[model samples]
Target: MDTTQLLKGVLDLAVLAVLKDEDGYGYDILRRLRTAGLDEVGDASVYGTLRRLFQAGLLNTYVVPSEEGPHRKYYGLNAAGRDQLNRAGKTWRNFASTMDALLDERGVAA
Candidate 1:
């Protein structure tokens, strides 16, 4: 299966989940996702998702000065984002369960 296609459907959820634990700048978030095993995740995808989530009012953004280089904009979840993450997580769990059952049955029944 093409994991990129699968990731597209859940990018919002994945981003929200990443911010659930801590705030992160765009590159930091992208790195965290990659470190967590989503090596195929696109840099543009994470940047776009951060912009979208901020616009949607699910995330809060603030800029921090960097003595070494350019300033960094960090994103953190607000109340709406937490609510969204909770709902999306439940939905994902349900969908994954059904898919797992179907796949398991197919293997045994074949």
Candidate 2:
């Protein structure tokens, strides 16, 4: 299975989950996700997801000044984002369990 492809489907959920803890700028969120084990997530993909989520009203963004560079746009989870995360989390748990069972069955059969 292509983990990267799978991750693409859940990238929005991942982004929202990260923002649920606190507001973060684009690069900051990307770094946090990478440090949390999503090493294969790309910068552009993360940035794009942020924009999309913001547009969809799931995220609220604000500007924070930076000493060494341009002001950064920080994102935080809105009420909708939080609700989405909760729903997605449930779906993911169920899907993961189903996949685990199927994989175990395949292993035994093999």
TM-score of the candidate numbered 1? 0.95
Residue pairs of candidate 1 with colliding backbone atoms: none
Question: Can you list the residue pairs that collide in candidate 2?
Answer: none
Which candidate number has the best lDDT?
Answer: 1
CA lDDT of every candidate: 0.94, 0.92
Per-residue CA lDDT of model 2 for 6-36, tens digit only, reads 9898999899889888999999999999998
- TM-scores of all candidate predictions against the true structure: 0.95, 0.93
Clashes of each: 0, 0
Distance from true location, Cα of 44 in model 2, Å: 0.7
